[model samples]
Target: MSIKILTILTLLVPTLSAFSQEKMVSVNGVNYHVLTTSLEQRKPSQPVLVFENGMGMGLGNWNTITDSLANDAPVFLYDRQGVEKSEMVYQQPTPQKIAANLKLLLKELKIEPPYILVGHSMGGIYVRAFAGYYPNDIAGLVFVDPADFTETKADWNQIFRTIGVSEKQIDEMLIKRLYTPLKVDSSRYAAWSEGQVLTDLRKTDFAELSSLPIPQVPILFFVGGKLEVPMERRSKDYDHERFFEVKNSSNMLRWRRFIHASSKGGALIYLSNSGHFVHRDDAAIVIGNIRMMLKAMEK
Candidate 1:
């Protein structure tokens, strides 16, 4: 290529990229980084897909998953408050406040109603709360190894101990690895550690949700077959099922029961070849399932 043409192309690329940078929104004094894919392509009658990341995970992890889904419809994802580029939030909020922020985000973004909410890990709880709070607005729900309120304090410790992670190790890892790179001050880390973040995330009022009339929306549960548990970290009775199981039972009987009781359509798929991060572990499964959902909605 000619020198003039090459120079022009290089200059145009960064300019185009700058136009595609992620957006930042402040709702109720909390700043957050958000990415909305293809709002222009979204149909007025169709529901938009909103993705909620697992605990400590940022929107960066959803690149492939969101892109694949965005091919058919709009997709949304955002970094949680105080994490990543969200302006380093320090004050912790309750579950209700988090859910309220999500509702507000959707309103301010002007995302069309009837959302297909997809959540992973603790995010599942948040989405569930969102669905419960605004049942009419949510068209479908997808849970990927979601955390539950059923897990007692003892259950949390036992499961962690069984997998060889002490509370101290968790605290140290968060400080040395997660916070250190962020250059977060010691006081903030101290405050975040006080609740053992995961422990705090598990404190949900699912019982009331379970007791309420089930929402008439489609639900999908993708059970990850692969686990990240190191052989040395697990006990002699180690099994991947136990590690990824949302409840105490290896068969996920609780989830199965919920499905059986629900009036809405639901499916249980075991991603035998994939692990917790099903988007990357088996994009085909996640994509195919989403396509199936899209097809069903067409009817």
Candidate 2:
């Protein structure tokens, strides 16, 4: 199962605080919590930085990164339905639907595009869906250890097999690893429920967009290193050291392919000190690359 991402919007502004003045944007009766810096408005042509959160995460996850991005460009951050102050209705939404809702929210807020989308984890997939659905609106993309939806199960199986891991071992590791805190809270939390549904139906719901060619935009990927199961979480079902090696190599290869396939190809920065949350682990790197993308788009 895979989770989708949350959305954020940025503008040319000063530093931001965690608890800033947030607007409750109403789109089709469901209210969304939108947190944006109060900066002098720029022209519509200037690309705004839109940050999306990983699966089962909220806009707060970006606090460290977004705070440093101050005064560079506009940043937009918002909670999707069922998260934070945002209200969720009963229906389950696909990535396209979530993107559509995001589009509507931007419109309601009067924020114009030529957007530089920054997505972490599952948010990467949502941003990709947005680019696929509204290609013209995107100016660039920054993926922070995004979920690899393009890879097939067979591909991973081969990776495990090469390390002398049996099929049963692979299955056990996956089952255990997939049982995250989000899964535990899904029955009680609306956000977790939506996240679970999105993850479960990711292949089916994201099939169309994922099948589309990679968007021809200035793209950047912030891939992490140090892929290992935590000591407390490690089990005898799989070899933790081997899994770490395979995960790191496999993800790097995939991201490289993505960068090469992009029309206006971008750079792939690997942070050895970082884990899955690259932005959180190495804030300086993420901020610098985002600045680079913004400057490139300006040209």
* Number of the predicted model whose lDDT against the real structure is largest: 2
Give per-residue CA lDDT, model 2, range 118-144, as digits (tens): 898878878888888888889888889
Q: What Cα-based lDDT does every candidate model obtain?
A: 0.65, 0.74
* Model 2 CA RMSD to the hidden true structure, in angstroms: 5.4
Residue pairs whose backbone atoms clash in candidate 1? 82-89
Evaluated at residue 252, the lDDT of candidate 2 is 76
Per-residue CA lDDT of model 1 for 156-201, tens digit only, reads 4555467666678545543553234334344454225323444444
lDDT of 1: 0.65
Runs of candidate 1 exceeding 4 Å displacement: 1-21, 149-213, 236-251
Per-residue error at 17 for model 2, in Å?
Answer: 14
lDDT of 2: 0.74
- The TM-score values for the models, in the order shown, are 0.74, 0.84
